[model samples]
Target chain A: MSQEPAVIDVPFEPHGLPPSVAGAAATTVSVSVTDLRNLRYDWVASAIPGRLLDAPLPIHSSFYETYHETPIKAANDVPRTIADALRGQLAAQGYRIGPDHADIRIGVIRFHEDIPSAQTMNNCFYNLIPETVSVVAIAAALVEVVDASDRPVFVKYYHAAHKVTPWCSPGQPIWAPSLLSLYRTNLIAAMRDMVGQIIGDSHFQEALAKGGRP
Target chain B: MKGAVIALAACALLTACGSIRFAVPYPSVGTPARTPGAANEIVNVVAKDDRTDPGGAVGRNGWQTLVPSNDPAGALAGGMRAELAARGYTVAPGHAQATLDLVSFAVDFLPNDLPLQASPGAPGGTVIATVGIIVIVRDPVARPVFAHYLQVHAAKPYYFNTSNAPDARTVLSEAMQSAITGMIADPAFQQAARRAQ
Candidate 1:
């Protein structure tokens, strides 16, 4: 007998506060931003940002790639695009952008959460649910940086050049701001001190010690 | 998903029950070549190097014994063979009309799998504090392909005998086999290859 899709409603309630800086004493740290690609997923075409179906690696692709010998500019451009986006968002929020003049540094980092399988995808689309099966959830974390000062400046950046759609055009887009709005919610959650602690502090050290980032 | 699983389980049960049968996904059979009107000769896959077999995945170390693809020829080449063969491609000894060369192979190791909750709350079952694996796959010849890395888990709460042989053997064979099967089944790869000269 075949089973029905379990419809396991994933709980994604708004977790915490959005990222923001309080004030002076160098409260901003424009961060290097990049995305964690979940290509291991089953229907990756839908999981990934459509704009980067053909973008280069490292900068816009996966950590499997590096900027060392790869000629493609998109390799390392991902971090730059992220830094620029965060700087712009911070500036718009009343924080100043500077090479080293900023206080309270903000770091935006994305890590892949899980992978999908073609079997699961086909099942989902066709309404087929297995009795018991495992599926990897496709996800990424967007971190917001805060200054160490008492004012506690909140530096924010909400776009990944890859998801900027048209702007994620690899080496072509040096600075793309297309993500300021769409990822605002996701980034805000990542920037929270409480949750960010998960990424900042040694919250999951046991796992980390067991394996390098997967 | 239920139907597929039920079908697969049924098939497995049938095998377990003594039905002596070999099957491949039907939708994937003879999907046709991409070259439009090319000679349609079988693509050749050559080993630029020597490939190793873990003697069927039973070894001294669970990680080491699992289908050894640590090297390019072993993992990368074997995967290409398996994936392609799964899709009904004949791997020739030498050059046919087209060829697969090991441009580059990369492996990623993840020490552990985090974001874990207490055992009772999640499905991971074990308190496996350390989890990681080596992803072995080939870089796309001309274009960037999706990740084909294999994930191997270690030191988890779940143990069925805890012998490296079964798990390592299962994973290694599955990874290599799937890689080749995937290559054959991918419509996108076929499209790109057809578009290429």
Candidate 2:
């Protein structure tokens, strides 16, 4: 049976803060970004929660291939876009973008779009027939607050996944350009939600306020 | 009429209870034609398959399945060499400018019996094929310029019918083809392959 689509609220209540810079905040924040996802495939598509089942190797008759090679710009371009968006979000929260030595440094740990088939399949088959696609965008980071001496004062990790949908109908194939476009659109929306979640959280706001200008 | 019924019942039993082995083709179509003398940089390609036979899956009536061949590492190395050669890079036996190694090749299926069903076919289940490669680009002096591990994954949905061998062949071929295409299409890969010796 298909369960209802999972609903997640943003800025999930922060767990009690740890000591050291526990109550610190900064006005200037620098962000370090990294892209670790496999850019070859359009997206992670799906990660079955448990162990995968083994099967036989049916593909026989080996042969060579010579095909035109096209660079995966879309996958390469996503990290830059997310970094730019985060900068804007941070600026709006009264944080200045600065060099690596800035008081607040946020390092992006992982960012990708996850489309779970089980969720999509359930959404389409159980809740409603003739279903559309379902996708979740993920953004995770490590936040480090340093004293003026560059000593680590406090550190916290944050990760968020948001469901965004244009729900491609069954008619829309996975490789269809339109589906990729929709996924990109949904990814942006999900990222925006995460930014809002982080900036609006009471704990983060307090951190920024401690040494913040505003 | 009664004979037809008995024959149909027997066929269903064979399909549902018996194991089926499918021979899927390696993806070689649509590869770009060899580029004319782009460069003389030599590249080495090596690969291997890591899936165990009668592998860890349980399908209907204990039906087990496989996707690639017993030795896909050999197949992938051959394919990679051909692809590099077509890109105008000279593939070599040793002391090359770059080496491409196939780290692993694997496939896992959901509802593992997508190609095994009773008389009529019903659509469900997905097959995911994953290929991992490591590219080491070296300068003329045998100095490593860059190295990176690249993995590609392809998934296809399938339906099983009384005669599933054909469907299995098609799906498995497509999955492998997609993976190969994905690997060579990497921007880093292009940059490395096109570098002058």
Candidate 3:
């Protein structure tokens, strides 16, 4: 007799403007300069282990074992990769990157990649077993901004996930190139989406304008 | 032989019923490399259990319910305190510039349909774990400078057993680690710590 999982409502939405800042007047001032700092990146991979269940016919099955292995790797420095892309995007928007005393400051609250994988081991038989592997890449980023006066501006979070098709069927090697390529591709897409959102938001544009001609 | 086969099947079925209790060991928070110019400001850490049932079921399927052997809130707070200390912050009680609240911790299980296989064996399913926390930073005058809610989730699949206690514990621990990691990695959290009185 399994019970229903408890339903607990979170006190607040995952992403939203706090009531105190939601109604603040949009800044009419415009500044063309800004600085980006405090970008951090965390890479988290699934810890689910592979299990081998021996269910033989004509005999009583009583064997079950689990094995752990690292099936994923981070091939590149994601933080630097995203930072470079962001700099180029901001430059195209007519915003100059200043070294110091900028009117506006941009910070990344969260930038992490979660690589979760699942395995399917062909059931039963005797020897010569077959298996299939599936993996998914999920990435999330949270960005925040502050005006020159150090007043809190706004915070926004973005996330995306994509499934990586296994390269070899009968038995795919853990470190297949296809796995890494697709994983990186999806993470980059998430970063692009974050940039697009920041530039497209009217509120963010207004905050940039408040920088007042650096 | 027939009797043996029936007994094996019966054993498997019996194993899947009733309530399963397991303890979630305190997660290990490794020593974080102190960032250059990182503040060592004092931070007050508080924890609360906001779940409707502290001793209630954390996970379940059609056959078994998973319950924790220890307090979820206490486990979360212990992890957070260790992580903050490793990040070069002084974690203590009393008036401080920053306060971290470990609000709620919960876990849920969603079992996938049995895969079409040649024979009957252990089935597979998934478990989703979530952790929520609030970070607040105040100025000398006690004016709130930064406040926000962060929720982190981790979902993983399990095989060889649908109601695997170790799998549930692992996912829950992963979610808890992410919550603390996410908070410390946030630029706003860093700024607030630096600005704390």
Top candidate when judged by lDDT against the true structure: 3
Calculate DockQ per candidate and list them.
0.05, 0.04, 0.06
lDDT (0-100) at residue B163 of candidate 3? 50
What value does DockQ give for candidate 3? 0.06
TM-score of model number 1: 0.27
Summing lDDT over every window of 10 consecutive residues in candidate 3 chain B, give the lowest-scoring window.
B111-120
Each model's RMSD to truth, in Å? Answer: 21.2, 14.7, 14.0
Candidate achieving the largest DockQ? 3
Give the TM-score, chain B only, in order for the candidates: 0.36, 0.62, 0.78
| Sort by lDDT, top down from the best | 3, 2, 1
What is the Cα-based TM-score of model 3?
A: 0.44
| Model 2 misplaced regions, further than 4 Å | A1-214, B1-24, B29-37, B48-62, B95-119, B125-128, B139-143, B148-157, B162-168, B185-187, B194-196
Question: What are the per-residue Cα lDDT tens digits for candidate 2 across A108-129?
Answer: 5435555533323333433333
* Candidate 2: docking tier: incorrect
Once superposed on the true structure, which residue ranges of model 1 sit more than 4 Å away at CA?
A1-36, A39-214, B1-73, B82-162
lDDT of 1 by residue, A1-214 (tens): 2211111111222233334433422333334444433222211221222212112221222211211111111112333443454445445444445543323232322321111222233344344443222211122233323223222222222222122122122232211233222233222332232233432333222212222111
Per-prediction share of native contacts kept: 0.10, 0.04, 0.04
List each model's interface RMSD: 19.4, 14.8, 13.4
User: 1 or 3: which has the higher lDDT?
Assistant: 3
